[model samples]
Target chain A: MKPIEARTERGRRAPPLPSPGVRFGEGFLDRLGRLALRVRSRRERREGGGEARLLGGGMEFVGFRPYRPGEDLRRLDWNLFARHRRPFVRVSRRESSERWSVLLDRSASMGTGFPGKLQLAAEVVLGLKAAANIEGAEVDLHLMVRGEPHRHRGRGAALAEWMELLESTEARGRGGLARLLAEPGRFKDARALFLVGDLADLQPADIPRLTRSGRDILLVQVLAPEERDPTRLPEATHGDAVRWADPESTGVRTVRLDAHALAEYERGLGARLEAWRAIAAHHRVSFTTVTSDTPFEAVVERVFAR
Target chain B: MSVPQVAAALALGIEWSRPSGLLLLGPAALLLLLARRSARPVERVTATFDLWEDAMRRIPPAPRTRRLPPLPVVFAAVAITCAALALAGPRIVGSDPPRVFTILCDRSPSTSLPLQPGRTRFEVALEACLSELARRAGSTDRVRWRSQDRETLELPVGVKPPASWFARPAAFLPEIEWEREDRPGFLWVTDRVPTPSPSHALVFASGGRGVPGPVASRGGERVVWREGGLRVEPAPGRVVELRGVEAGRLGPLARLLTIWARERGFELRGGQERERALLIEAGRGAGETRELRIAGGSLGWGLAGTGGAGGIAELPEGAQVWRFGEASGGEAPILVAGSPGRVLLAFDGVRSVEGDPALFALAWSRFLDRWVLPAPGVVPLDERRDAGAASWDEWSEDRFEEVPRVGAGRGETTSADLLAPALAGIGVLFATLAILLSGGGISWLRGRLPASRTRT
Candidate 1:
């Protein structure tokens, strides 16, 4: 499937990506395969399923619990009920038949950074799709472009088709995470939903609403190293003044790089990060920050290993 | 003095000409203040207004102080002062009073004696007079030349003696003016000591050479034969004889004999026909020609013949001759004669005379006065000595101070334009300083402005 063109705040199309193909070299694939194996092992040991907790018929027993009145008799363990003279249900581990839905933010803000947040997020998405395919789960790629969601579904090798489309996508437009995820019908069947973006424009209040749609919501905030600590940016600390331009909105601000102003900026940024952490905790959504400079394998290992 | 009194005195001392330039200072100061408000540095920023506004609200505003801007105020003050000074026409008050000077210059024959080889005492005295006059006498000073107690000539102030005046005959006064009062200081230039005077005066004596003093003699009807000519003493009706040589051969000597005989009232006979009271023989060896050589005669009182070719005489044994004609080997006298009665000529004829006639006449006139003139009861005044001896002790410093100040008229006043270049220079300096100070002050003020964030 072809990726939709991202739009800017002015409703103008952004520049196209440099190339239409993303090459995964043998070494990169080997690293990614090892990371995927680790993720599967860890998930199996912890939950007996791959990144999900869905009920299904399986031979491995999970646990027993008191049977409810309306529960099916087939689930009842008669042998345990005769010994205990109480009705107990037999619970088997669910099969690892899960659907993975990846929501990628194709916003102008993601266009900043060394490897670019969009590029890093695409790599992360590709790694996740590969891991999901390996685990025999169906994967869907949903790209949020210009505040609209476009989805593409595939299984196995077909899941790899979206790599080219993801590579062709340029970072443009503003992504509305909460609004896109609030429509739960499209992603109701998906066991795990991954939202990948810089997340700079997202408000803390939007987190809980976004978490309601997906059974498990993984928020991978793909930020540039400069965005996390602006002082590390080469141009930020040099001159008496620095100008910051927002990629997602028509907003610009210039400030003196004096001690007081730099301290204030750091404080504001810290508060924003803390607020996001609090929101994530409150919503029970898995949250992790990944800098664009991090290696793809490292990100995969860090985000998917549990 | 009190400050206001001093200021008033200064204000009264200066007169102003242009009072309009002071208006510029007001506008300049206002413009400078406005410029300070606008020159603050501006910086561009983005949509962080909410955060920035909050941060700014947290920061307390700086305290306000009531004080003037030092540099600007100083610059303005300097500029205003300079402008005010320039606008006002300034002048100093007062006048220089004029004075009158009177100069009394001595004009005497002895002043002609040479001080140096070429410069006469008269010339030196004249030079000194001119120098003194140029020094102390202004153009309006009065000057008069006095000789023999009379004003020979009056000179305009600052007038130099004519170049020919040095070569001209000496000015002689016939009589003295005794009634004039000496008010202004008198300057006497002479070669002799003058008698004392009661007025304020300064004497400049050129005392290089001494003049001959008056001679005293006791005689009755004496006929003296001195060098150059003969003289008769007390000759009321003297008879003189010229026994040798014809009148035609006598030449200049005949003319001298006629003038002398007329002055002495002598009856002259050409030959020795009557009883001769005196005799003058012109031809060589015609009469007894005594060659008496004088020993150290006074050359100052004698005539020195100039040029070659004139009658020569023999000197007495061991006599020292001052000057003589070439005919006698320049050692003998120019004439040989007796002291009181007889006279003789060494030349064959006076036609051979070729010397200074006036000088020769002066020598003979002096001889006549010594031998023929009667002794008077009183000696004639030596004008140079009288002028030189005139006492200037009365001309003390106090008397000099009393001389009316000449040259400048009374109540004279002058305008001193004190504002042209001096006040203009001060104004320009103040203006330049003001400009520089304003620029620097405005820069500092702009730096002090609050930091701003704006769009690029």
Candidate 2:
């Protein structure tokens, strides 16, 4: 038989494209607008073993009481020490960190839950950008894409432009944070760094690479609730067969979601988080892991512990 | 009724006291349907299965459930049915095999003697026989009573006996037929146990006690004594002769005697009389008008207490004195026994007796029982004065043995009403099964059972 000619209506439109906006209420943006940033860091000396002070240097001079043992000798007010027998330093800066860095993981795993991890990552980015503006720091935006990362340095990209870029961006390929960081000539050092991702394919040794001795590094690990506890998801049943499809790869697994299975998952997830916490502490990096359902303000507070 | 007709009606029969209670089944059926519908298949989808993979490696898969629930619905239905049936009050409707009762009662003069103050020995025996009959009696049973004064009374089991069946004891008991004995249900009730204990008849003796007093009807209508028994109805055989004066001239005495004669069921022929059994005179005897003292034993013979005859009269030769005048001691008589073959009550007005109808009746009763009847009269002797409260065993004969009664045994046809509790137990059993099937109690049972036995 001859191939049938097109008899269907050409006017039938293709399925409409999805909107590119984060799944959050306007109340979150309002809370984000009211926030201000204050970063504290221990500045390590490159030439010596002992750490040096960065808190005493800034644009304006402030009053001081006494000099610390490990502080730089140049920060001491010599005139005040001559008038009084006490040795006092001039504390002029709120924080020495002038530049902030934000690196977002745009991997397929972030796209895998209701109120997706990617959306939370986007909200977390907005929160950091606002804080950096309040602290008058030049922020650099790095997108860990499938083939290569996109870097936006200093204040060259506007706030509107960053949001537009984040909204338009789709999580496509497997680009874990540790593997991206190990690549040569790709990233640069900054006074503070904000890493937003689910920490997939990460190892304990990679935590030091994200930090310099004087760096104020905060790792905001965003996750879908189901990654930590499957019972937290609506799709889970006490004893039902489930089909799971991995977003990045063609791997599919069939599972019976029973109480035993849920218990095993919880135990593994807990141990994983604890390992990450230990490694982060060793590197003196601020670390926080939160689900997509958590408030942005709460996550920031946990990361800085303020 | 035949064995075949009984067999047809008896197979697995049930009758409900409240058939309306079965209406509960409608709602119960609906409930079963609803339970079945609730068993819809459960399906869900989740994000990941990594931990599930680990758990699955250690534990077995969940058991497959059917789209519809069978265990719960079946249990519920059965429980409802049992409850409804229990409420309905089931009773067995099967017929019993035919039974027979052949009862015989003693008609001796002593049988009329009172065992207690109210009932005679014969009455006590009759009551016992009736009770036994009623206990085991069914529609198919047959009963025959060779009663005291009748040939054979066809007593309907489980019903009231006819009034005609209750006949009085004879003055002289005839030779009874106890040799042609009946089978298992044969019963013979008597005042005294007979000699050579019956080979087949179940003999029950009342143990005769007390001198015979006034005999009452089963309904307690008391009557005067007549010879061997109180209220004994004799055959109409007496001829009353009027001598020396016409019955018309005797006036009230003649009329009063006529009424008394009718009341006693005796047809007394007067006026143109033939050779008679009794004689009455208006004119003289030997004594003048004087009250006579009664004999010592006169009271026992049912005379008016303390006093004697109120009038004087002549008595026959070889007279046994019952009453005496003032001068005569116990030797002279106002009343006496007549000749051996023929008897008379010489009721002459010259005896000067007071006009007391009840006394006349008492005197007449004594005269009739002692002189008129064929058998010896039962005098209210002092030997039996307090026999009312004494044990009946006091009068048992040497051969008498009291037989223990197994009430309503063997061929009794009554159906039991124990089905209610059994139905309730069945309901509880169904409820237990339901609980097991639902797995509500499975955790408690888990320790006792193996891992493989658990459903999920």
Best by lDDT: 2
- Tens digit of lDDT per residue, candidate 1, span A1-306? 111111113443333322222344557657667767876676565443222222223335676767766445666789999999998776655345577788777766667666677777888887887767655567788876545777776654453467667767877665645546667677777777788876665677876755543256778887677556656744445533344445545443444444565566567767877888888777656778878788876776666644
- Across all models, the iRMS values in order are 14.5, 14.2
Can you tell me which runs of candidate 2 are displaced by over 4 Å?
A1-28, A37-97, A234-237, B1-456
Candidate 2 C-alpha lDDT tens digits along A177-273: 6556665244565677777888775666777766665566778888777776677644354454344544544444445455666666677677778
Given candidate 1, what's the lDDT at residue B140?
A: 49
Native contact fraction, candidates in order: 0.07, 0.18
lDDT of 2 by residue, B1-456 (tens): 345434543664666657777787787788877776654322222223343344455555544434455776789788888888887766555433344567777666566667768987778876766665565455656677775456576556765456655555323455456665533566776665555666545666666545645332211133445445456443324455555555554445566556655554444555644434445443333444333333343332222211223333555433344443344545454543443222333234322234455665566555553433332233333322322321121212211112211334553433343566678789889977876776665655675576746745
lDDT (C-alpha) at residue A134 in model 2: 52
Q: Name the 10 consecutive residues with the lowest summed lDDT in model 1 chain A.
A: A1-10
Docking model 1 quality class? incorrect
Q: Against the true structure, whose TM-score is highest? A: 2
Instruction: Give TM per candidate.
Output: 0.35, 0.36
